[model samples]
Target: MDLSWLIPIVMTAGGVVALIALVAVLARNLKKVPPNKVLVFYGRKHTTEPRHDADGKVIEAGGTKGFQVVTGGSKWKWPILEDCQEMDMASFQMKPQLKKIPNKDGVLVNVDAVASCKIKSEQSSLSAAVERFLGKTTQEIHAMVLEILEGQLRAVIGTMTVEQLIQDRETLNTRVKAEAMSELEKLGVGIDILNIQSINDDQGYIEALGKKRTAEVVRDAAIGKAEAEAETKKRSTTAAKDADVLAANNQAMTFEADKDRDVKKATYDALIKAEQARAEQAGPMAKAEAEQKVVVQQVKVDEERERANIEVQKQKALVAAQAEEAKTVVPARKAAEALVATAEGAKKKLVIDAEGNRDAAVATAEGEQKKLVIESEGNRDAAINAATAEQKKRVLESEGARDAEINAATAQGQKLELEGKGKAASIRVIAEAEVYQAREVGKAQADAIEAKLLAEAKGILAKAEAYAKMDQRGALQLILEKLPSILEQLPAIVEAAAKPMSAIDKVVMIGSDPNAPAKFAGNVPVFLAQLFETTKNLGFDLSGALKKLGIDATAISGPDAPKVD
Candidate 1:
């Protein structure tokens, strides 16, 4: 191959290939432009036509039909016939500088705030309409955004004071959001929020307002404190007045009570005086009545004395008349006696015969006395014999009684012996049976006690092991101290056994010894003394036992020991 000829041909081929690649790139770029941007076509007329609903209902007039809105991607169109401009839908922050406009209160304040917004679809379409009407540029959009936000912000700031704008940010923000949102919505744009970032005002005005509020608060507090003090004083005054009124009432009541007491005293005194006067009159009136009665009784006595004197005089006269009559009858009686004497001689002999008969009667009585004497002697002899028989009978009865008594006594003794022997045998049998039973029981109890003691010992060993491991000297010391107390109770056990056997012979024979075992001879006293000593040393109680022994615990310590009696 010839190198020189091949170089020109290769260069020509490379140029052709490059031209093809350029055309392919231009075609690819044309395809890519449709996705990245949008195109809007505007006709000669700037006015928009009315839009219609899908249901053929008439809607508001909007952008002209020659103009079209393209969003998100590009559109294929004649470049000469349409103009395409990109209006961003993304949010943007617009800080608008606004001049101080006086509020309703005529206070000037500079309002600084931020507005967040995005272009609306309808307003973006209106760019084509605006190009027809005014022109198409960012300047118009920026002017529109600023014009809307600035008018709204100025209106908001003008409605409020500088203090409100500064302090009440939330209220300011709410006003901004409302006004800006409504305005932006009307313009087919979206506003996120309108914030009053800051407000600049005269410091003197703010400080004066703060001082005024503080003074008002302090004045209110002072007024409240004064009112509280006044209320307390009023209550104290009222309480004092009430106390005075109560004291006066008590004084009045006391005076009334005293007056009542005086009235009662006067009434009691009058009653006593009247009673005394009546008592004094009663003795005088009684004396006068007694004197009148005595005078009447004396008159009756005088009348009775006069009547007695008259009766005595009448009796004396009657006695004298009877004596005269008796004296006259005495002479006649003497003459009659002389005549009777002659006849008496014969009468004397008859009287002598009567005297002899009387003597004979006397002699008969003497004979009767002798007969009575004989009968009396016989009766005396009979009485003596009867007395002798009675004495002999009494002696026989006494002898029989003695024999009967001896027989009865012998029988009673035999019966008592049998009964006593039976009773003693029964008691001995019962005692033996009880002892046998007790021995069995004691063996069983001993076994139980041994088991319990073994178990306690095991437990004590376990506890001691634990205590030893822990080195607890206190527990070991307590057990050692208590050992004597347990041992001291042994005497009580013996006493309990012996107490039920008081009727048994005092000299007990143990192990077939007739004489008491040496150990048993003084065992009770020795055991008791040992128990007392052990209990005393162990601090065990023996006051109850000392009482039974008729000894006072306090007295037993000295020469003043109580006497056994």
Candidate 2:
């Protein structure tokens, strides 16, 4: 073979085949589809057209007029009439920087968030829809996602307080998720929320917020604790008071019952005494009645005997009168006889009559003597009976007087005893009242002191909070540095106010070396002296102030110094 002739033919054939293969490769490449991507073709249609299927249902690939969508492949088309675009269905990752303006709190927080999304395989029209509505670039989608995320974050964060945002992370996350869902759903994009990449706020504002929250939490905790303690104390106090009141009521009831019992007992005793007195009087009355009955019987018997004796005496006197009359007649007859001897029988009768007259005078005198003797005897007996009756009456009267005297003495002793018991009861009541008053006064004083101490502690706590929030270390250093000066001035102030400092010996010192006792002691006395000297014009007693600082004359003199460790 001639090499030159064969080379031309070969070259011509190779060029023809090469051109054909190149065209075939280009066509194949055009027909082949990329995975998770789509190509859309529009034919001379500037307006957005609805795509549908053959049955008049909306289609994902072909539009109603002349638009067609090719998914995951390249298609051959007429260059003059067809326009094509690529829509990626692959997962896309984006980080959007978002700025949120807080409402009413003047807080501007910047949020960096990431979003992942992918086109739905079932909704291939998404790319066309996106192309029509938004620019067919990742920048616009990224902007949309950022705007949506930003809006959602702001909407979520704006509804919450800074404290809630800072403290309640879960609530923030939930709220963000919800807001993002609502906003992203409207963007026609499937979204996978990754994370809030970062959040940033002004440093000063964050510090301020932290301080404010800390202060608020501390204050609230303190208030709640104090309230709980106060409530517990109040409940305990109320219970104690109720118990005391109940006890007092019981005591009063018991006292009243005792008083009533005592009164009843006294009444019963008085009744018993009265009954005894009545019994005693009844016995005396019965005895007196018996004596009276006996006396009546005896009197009756004496009366009968005396009457008989008087009758006998009267009969004897009558007999004596008769005998005397007969004697007188005989004497008269004798005298009459003597006279009749002189003048016969008639003269004798006259002499007898004269003798009888003389005898009658003598007999009458005897009868009169007997009558006088009987009368004397009767008078003596009557005198003796009357004397006996008078003696018995006197004895009964003496017995009645003795009983009356005894009763009076007994009543006087009982009255004295009752008065002593009443005096003792009055003394007890007064003592109890004084004790109660003292207890109440002590309790009131204790409560006042507790309140005062609590108020002082609150004031101190408020000052500490303000200082700590302002500049924590600086404020602490300032307080520590000024403590000594404050302590030194206190004694002078007290002395200037004409108050004694003997009770205020313990003073707190700060910024002084704790291990070196002399370091504090040496400076403290000088500070006290300076303070006292400054207030000397105000009539402050320097010596008294020094003494109050535990720097007496002896302490100032020798090696003995106050230890301040």
Each candidate: how many clashes?
Answer: 2, 23
Residue-level lDDT for 179 in candidate 2 = 72
Please give the lDDT score for candidate 2.
0.57
lDDT of 1 by residue, 1-565 (tens): 6599988899999999999997775554342134333345454344656767799875566554546555555444443554544444456678887755676577766667788876555544345333432334656666787788888887887788766776788988888778876776655566776777766555355567767878998999999999999999999999999999999999887876775675465345434433443344345446744764564455445434444544443344334333433343333344334434433543444345444544554455445445555667676555445544544454455445544554554455555555555554565555455545545554555555455545655564565456446432453354346546644754665455345346556542323334436534444444344334433333333443455447665443333322211
Q: Please report, in order, the local distance difference test score of every candidate based on alpha carbons.
A: 0.56, 0.57
Kindly list the per-residue Cα lDDT of model 2 for residues 380-428, writing each as its tens digit: 5554454444434444444345444444444444444445445545554
TM-score of each: 0.32, 0.30
Model 2 TM-score on a 0 to 1 scale: 0.30
Tell me the lDDT of model 2 at 540.
30
